[model samples]
Target: MAQAGFEDLVETFEFLDDWEERYRHVIELGKALPDMPEALKVPATKVEGCASQVWLHMTIEKGTLTFIGDSDAIIVRGLIAVLITLYSGLAIEEIGKVDVAGELARLGLNEHLSSQRSNGLRAMVARVVQTAAAAA
Candidate 1:
């Protein structure tokens, strides 16, 4: 099951008819995300494989996982916001159960994103899942 925040996003996407509108919405979402503290952007949190510089600082408390992320590219930052909605507040055990690809397809992201962005998204998901597995 997707998180409530993600479900809300899906609803909004459904209301928007054009890809351009959806794209703009995604950028706005990114703009809405709070800045990730510079101190947390260290190599330890840096995600490899993204064309854009990206970092995700994760924390788990009482078995729930959450993260703050940033990306050098604006659209990538929006993608990070999407990922946060998809995965944050989930229990560590639940992370592996999520169908990341299937969920993304619902928003038509798979077809729209460039190969590089798709690969980067996959890498980010991998990082989150790996961290959750280790925590679990």
Candidate 2:
């Protein structure tokens, strides 16, 4: 559920012609995000530079990486939900192997967001990548 799943998501977005529909689709996808347990949401894991209070954490076991994240804002939580779909279920090294910018373009998110939203998305990706790197 890495590369192929990512590609499928891109295809799914392309099937939508309206931005509002796309947003709804994205939010629906967000609902599929694995539940983030309350115990993992702490200050140190909290990501700054976001419009909302977001907490992100990682734990690697048997060489596979797992993410735990949450946000105080609904939209940002949905955004992080997108992040989890892209990066979770991968090994730490594999997470580092991704070209996030390219993937964003492939997913059509790069062309479809406000400048600030795009920047916030990149920040989220950076945090996920940094977490993977540390685990590696």
Computed on alpha carbons, the lDDT of every model, listed in order, comes to: 0.94, 0.74
User: What TM-scores do the predictions have?
Assistant: 0.98, 0.84
For 1-58, candidate 1 gives per-residue lDDT tens digits of 6678999998988899988998998899899989999999999999999999999999
Q: In terms of TM-score, which candidate is strongest?
A: 1
How high a TM-score does candidate 1 get? 0.98
Clash-forming residue pairs, model 2: none
Give one digit per residue, the lDDT tens place, for model 2 in 3-59: 566667778878888778878877776666566788777777878777667788877
Model 2 scores what on Cα lDDT?
A: 0.74
Give the poorly placed runs of model 1, Cα more than 4 Å off: none
What's each prediction's clash count?
Answer: 0, 0
